[model samples]
Target: MSTQQTISKHLDKSVIWLFVIVFLISASVFAYRYKNYKTCEDVAFTVKAKEFRVGELIKFTDNTDQAANWEWDFGDSTDVKTNKEVLHIFNKEGEYKVRLLVNNICQDEKTVTIKEKLFIIDSTKLPVFNVKSSIVVGETLNVEDKTNNASTWEWRFGETTRVNSVEKRASYVYKTPGLKTISLVVNGDVKHTTTKQINVLPIEKKEERISEITGTNRRLGDGIKARPLGYEDKDKEKTKDEPSDKPKVVPFIGDSQFISKLELVSNNKLDANAFKEYFCGDINKNIIVNGKNTSFLIFCEKIKNKKLRIKDITIYREKGSNCINTVTISQNKILGIF
Candidate 1:
């Protein structure tokens, strides 16, 4: 064979191999482009509603894997977050159409119903009474009126029931004499009860013991002389008109010359207005001191200080009322007798 012909054949074979390689490379590039191209249905997605309430937080999870973005329409006339756990509030009560659009490719939706819940208020009550002060024992006192709000009433007299009833005015007679506790329960509520002490004394006990004292007229000017007062009852009287117990002092002082008509109390407390009405002048006053009672009468012309300083001193019996042994004292130094 000729050398030029063989060389020409070899060049043609090389050109054919080069063309085959270029064609194969172009086909691979076209196949790669076609594989990567996406349709509208590729990145599609949808969302399903789980559960929600009027004030509850709901989550909308996008179940699509290829979706790039999510759009949530919470159907409450408001837009909500498009995350996995999206929170939304349903203010009104009704069925809601909750819609979700995924990556502009696909759409998913669900419906949920919300309702209103009822609420109640809490309260506390306290008991009350009408009268609460100064209850005397052994006295059948009427109980205070109970209001209509009190549906129940209970009474406890610190003992078994001698008188038991639901009447508003209840009587409780204290059998024994001492401090007694009384309780009243109203409307199933208990309150701190009050205590009343009864002072019971015998009925036939003697009442008055103080007897009147009189002195001679010539010796009366020696600063008003009088013996130590003694108690006398009806039988053991030193004089015929005296009672015969230990005679208590029946002393009366007034502002006038009339002194015999005033009423004297047993505890040495005297009523001055009665003495003043019996006497003519203004009844200055009288008081008891050191187991002795004395009376005074001072005129307005004899006033020294702005206030009258009436001296009520202790008086010892000056030996058959010859001269009364006494000590001068201020007004505050003696027990007051009005």
Candidate 2:
């Protein structure tokens, strides 16, 4: 054979082997991808929930084969999680679309409806008793139970000679006058007990009351008095000698007068000196205005521009001393009147 012909034959053989190898590799890759695609298409999952109420927990389970990873979306604007089995809780009552993704490629979804739970027991409605705290002796006392979810009731009338009853409502009469304790108990899975006191008073008699009144009058006559008996002339002389420190009676001002004063101040008809006299403190350039210590001129300037009226004024006096302590004035448009 010629050298050129031999070299061409070898080159042709190498090209054929390379083509076969390439075909084999392509076929293997195609087969692998086809298997994975079929597995993804056949992916399935199930959602299990014991209850569909708010605050209930739900479980998600992936039931597909050939899955390497899992992801879940609870559809409640929450963060997505990656797990084969996931547990989630809904905070509100609404319909939520739950989804499960297998191998990050195949997915399935289901809608869950969460509703609000009803028939919840309130703590305030627990077993309780209601009865009058004071009753006169010889009068019948009636008591009622305000208990809830109780199957039976027990009541104790707190009398030595009285008998207890299992009825919800009970009545008892006492012949004595004093403090008495009443108790109640409700029978159920959990027993509840409550106790109260009643003050039983004795009926008053007119003859015994008249003697008591005379005795009280005698005790009052024995106490100290402002003036001695038959000393009215001397007491009048002493009163003339000493001047009283009592505050003189001032005529009550109506709401109209207060409104007129406010209007005059706002219209510049009333000066600051006159306005300051209405307050209890010393008139100066600065005073507390609206809880803040500020210049009196600024305070007056603010009110002068606004239409204002005094709503109310309360004057407080020091106890025993009877001297005026402070005056609180409430205005319709302005604050901080001390």
CA RMSD of all predictions: 31.6, 22.9
Please, what are the lDDT tens digits per residue for candidate 2 over residues 1-338? 99999999999999999999999999999999877663577777777778877788888788888777888888888999998888888987768888888877788888988865423444464558777878888998988887766668766555531236778888888776755556565773221235566877889776643444333345655777686677658777988999689644333434466457657877988744453333322222233332433333334445775667556655554454333333445554333222
Clashes of each: 16, 0
lDDT of each: 0.44, 0.63
Worst 10 residues of 1 by lDDT: 297-306
The candidate that wins on lDDT is: 2
- Judged by TM-score, which candidate is best? 2
Identify the runs in model 2 with alpha carbons over 4 angstroms from their true place.
1-38, 125-338
* Superposed Cα deviation of residue 212, candidate 1 (Å): 72
Deviation (Å) of 3 in candidate 2: 28
For candidate 2, the per-residue lDDT at 308 reads 72
Candidate 1 Cα outliers beyond 4 Å, as residue runs: 1-51, 118-338
lDDT by residue (230-280, candidate 1, tens digit) is 744546454786555642333433222222222132223333344432222
Error of 2 at 255 (Å): 59
